[model samples]
Target: MSKIDIRTVNVVQYVCPLREGGSLPAIVKADDGFLYVLKFRGAGQGKKALIAEFIGGEIARAIGLKVPELVFMNLDDSFSKTEPDEEIQDLLKFSVGLNLGLHFLSSAITYDPLVSNVDAMTASKVVILDSLISNIDRTAKNTNLLNWNNELWVIDNGASFYFHHNWKTWENHLTRTFPLIKDHVLLQKATSLEKASEDIKQTLTANKITEIVSNIPEDWLISEADSMSPTDMRNAYIEFINAKLSMIDLLVKEAEDAR
Candidate 1:
């Protein structure tokens, strides 16, 4: 896979807050004249959520999923002063540095699985990707998918890699099966989990995994309790992914049985 170069843009204007979740991500216009769904680094989840978004979105794109372009957005303190809402102002003030931004789809519609038709191959690939990354957010209740220009786009991957939140027990769960796959929105429509796993395994090479993990900003991987350095954290992520890839067959079986 080719290297993904994430652009850095300044936030020119604060449009509005997307009050859907607790993280307080907002829709902001950037200096590039493109609107972005900006995830604040100072939000409740902190930088780890941004790390997950970067890694998960890039991995999804590598395996032929349609994901919006990601960029590093610089938030200036002055921009927060214009906000009318006190809560939003506080969020903007706290996130004064680099934040994760997803290129916004202006007219995209939220994906409704009941009304939408996703083919078997695409569904299988999505399931495989989620399982590999241990994303527990893509349930039927909240697919985290968007429909735009007749294409399905994956979004909101910050909820992935839950194990990273507790690095102390990360090793124990590294080889564990993802039981959450049973509730995956695409599971019923998915077929051929083995083929999907093979396709992802072929695309997500070790170097590509390292590159994706390395893309995360050094400050985002802040060490806690002297557990590991930022570089070690990146290596740990690569190690976990590689270990998961080695056990693709087991994950595939788990998903298949769930379906």
Candidate 2:
């Protein structure tokens, strides 16, 4: 509805690493006195992952999905000295500057389809959001869905928008279909794709998408092989999202066929 206001805080402490993922995201405490799962800008996938996480979370929120509150975290170089693990200390040393964090949903358990039932609308929304972002992580293997306080919450969207990884040919994938939808954890539960698409069409306006894309830090858009300016990268993201949105009917069909 308006410019998305994201909070920025200084990371004060590195709690522990969620080492299961390659990014080595850690539970860090911020000056705001809150625990957040911090995604470092220096990690394997680097800032693009954070950008994807930022864009994906904002898009999920716009479509009325429950996503943990995302905030911009300023990581100081000094914090690296406190970390005893040399590997983690190196990550801290390199990730100095802006990073991304999701407000930790304490005690939340991973969603197991057999254990938790997701409603049709929410399931449909999740399917639609994942399709739009071309997210490749949410599968039977890693649902990436959390049950927080009895509500379905989406998390770890860093694997989305894979096209950005190869900016040279990224446009070729703008019209590509997400065949991987077949592996989606909620495919069978997304029974109302048409309705969900209709609803998202109303809320996820181009202006709103642009607003979210605009929040990506300028430095994150820079790459040695990529000469595109930050503005160009931002515009590319908006274009990719809208292009995918225009194909919602096709995506719905793909998801349906997958089942």
Candidate 3:
């Protein structure tokens, strides 16, 4: 297992906007050190984004993948000269000089997405895992998976809320379905679906799921977010994660019991 150490770095020169919602810089550290630049935002964005990153990353790490060390760091707003999109600029103006907490993922030194370091079987397993987790971030366009030195690493989990939308009333988003698991490579690696399923089930347990959502900073929740209390919102999210976890558990447990 890789260890992560968190520290502050002066990233003034490396700041750049990302193609996505935030901006960060590619930073270099002293020999044996690694770095990444994260955009700073006000407390208003709610901490849901960060929470998603935390949970996704934690789970990824548990499942035998390399996840970069993540930290919440304040940035000097003046460091990045490239003006943010007009809307982001206005939003920041109101907060005035507040440092946005940036999430730094150490660069994967030997990873390349365009090339496959793992077999196609492993890739299939990864896709199934992402699909079951409802991670909307890792589509073909983003392809956050990388192969470095014969190992695969997953990154950039900022878009993990596919199941958080209000589903109580059968909203349109309910159309989304968990991906088929039968042909997946990673899912098959399980001694039986039972082990993998139990792993996911434990992750989505009521308390664990609730903790993940509740831990989200108030700023990351959307403005005019659902009227539910944080606890209620958290409970709702628990149900969402449970839906998938339960399925995995059932699949794996029954298989294990049968054998």
Candidate 4:
């Protein structure tokens, strides 16, 4: 895990529920100043939720998006707890959550789909990354994109890769035809996005993809989930990131040629 600096004091004893699922609002003190409340995954969501936030947020940040900072927490489990239904009551009944949380985003007042900003090429890249990771949570309803200080910030990555069944199944997700390969938007504006795909392809082979997966935490893949082990799930993601990196070169070339 990469080192992240965050202040964890002024822990609010309770969590104020937010409209979003698996999250709550609570006040805390950070390095910048006092924040009214930071949004955290519901206590019932458990540690995997925090891990998802950490890894997913890091990937997006590496890809050059403004992602809110996430940190491990030490909070009382009583804040904003949820009751379980009959089917999975046992599982939910005994779960405790780490105060592991992210920096409170103060200015994200609303969510707007910037379809124009997200040109067809950029859209294709986003979709390609989403599909390869088996990320089914980024629909219109679940787009975690928000406008803040005149720019966009992305959030919520816990629902990705839920459909990964095996290593081959995972590998196939990365094998898309790259139809919109010509329209990568980041090619022109951001150097990071420029030629990203080609760079990734040059550096990341199947073996490297496997190594990335091998690094995932063991608890992330539910035992009953698609019969996947943490290793399988990790490998699945390795393919996604490696493919994304490879696409960077194509993106850069497209941008340069367009200019």
What are the RMSDs of all candidates, in order?
Answer: 1.2, 0.9, 6.6, 6.9
How many pairs collide in each candidate, listed in order?
Answer: 0, 0, 13, 23
Residue range with the least summed lDDT across 10 consecutive positions in model 1? 223-232
Cα lDDT tens digits, model 2, 50-151, are 999999999999999999999999999897888889999999999999999999999999999888878999999999899999999998889999998889
Residue-by-residue lDDT tens digits, candidate 3, 1-259: 2333334344334344444444332342222243453434442333454555656765565455566655544344553334556655543343333222334443444334444455543454355356555666564455666555457777656556544545355233333454433333233333534344444444445655555556554554544656666666556556655565556544444333432
lDDT of predicted model 3: 0.48
Q: Rate the local accuracy (lDDT) of all candidates.
A: 0.89, 0.92, 0.48, 0.48
Evaluated against the true structure, the overall lDDT of model 1 is 0.89
lDDT of 4 at 208: 44
Better of 1 and 2 by lDDT: 2
Highest lDDT model number: 2
Q: Regarding lDDT, does 2 or 3 come out ahead?
A: 2
Candidate 2 Cα outliers beyond 4 Å, as residue runs: none
Residue 70 of candidate 2: its Cα lDDT? 100
Q: Which stretches of candidate 3 lie over 4 Å from their true place?
A: 1-14, 19-34, 37-48, 76-114, 119-125, 165-176, 179-195, 198-211, 249-259
TM-score of each: 0.97, 0.98, 0.61, 0.56
